[model samples]
Target: MAQAHHMRIGEVAERTGLSLRTIRYYGEVDLVVPSARSRGGYRLYTETDVDRLQLIKRMKPLGFSLDETRELLAAVDGLSADDTDEDERAALAERLDSFEAAIADRCVTLRRQLEMAEEFAERLRRRRAGRAASA
Candidate 1:
């Protein structure tokens, strides 16, 4: 069997654009536990671990709570497992679909909020310009 290459926490943090503290916290919460530990007791991660952290990072911006993120991760893991039975796979797929729908709804809400914020900023800019013109 081929051994997977491992990275220390700093390297994983660099790759995932997450702070060391955040990574450690995630590990504590079992969101993205390290694949191994070094002789010196440093957290060591594999590429798969990094990928998990990246997924969590993406989900964070979508406003998923930690528990929700963990649930989604569990569903993803179940779906990916080769030993998952067809019945389990169907349930996991259904969970994934629900998450997808929630994400899409959140994204639409975010877009609407962003548009309103931009419009407000534009209105302010126009008001400033009008004041300057009169000055």
Candidate 2:
């Protein structure tokens, strides 16, 4: 609501490390719509929207499904909004906690995958170096 400068789709893509197509697709899917439209009918985004896009980018690597992402965004938005109902706060808090646990689990899995990938790379490097030394 209170951004010093609005950003266009290209700026949003550059800042978020997301492709322009992906940002537009997110809008099409109702995942994260832009806050406003320019005089030229281009999409315009606020700082808050940029932060949301970054959150989506962070989630991408964790393999969250579209439904999961939608749910997470809903929970986050509810918590962040000013007029969240008293009854809904507790449930949103629980959802945030559950998401935290899920992300922790995913981190463990990703770490293991990274270790395996590093080992595979090391093996290839060793083989290549050994071949060059013998040549």
Per candidate, the number of residue pairs that clash is 0, 0
User: In candidate 1, what residue range of length 10 has the lowest lDDT sum?
Assistant: 30-39
Winning candidate number (lDDT) = 1
Best by TM-score: 1
lDDT of 1 by residue, 10-128 (tens): 99999989999999999999999889999999999999999999999999989999999999999999999999999999999999999999999999999999999999999999999
lDDT of each: 0.97, 0.93
- Model 2 Cα lDDT, one tens digit per residue, 31-64: 8999999899999998988998888888989999
List ranges where model 1 is wrong by over 4 Å: none
Clashing pairs for model 2 are none
Model 2 misplaced stretches (Cα beyond 4 Å):
1-4, 130-135
**Reference-based TM-score, model 1:** 0.98
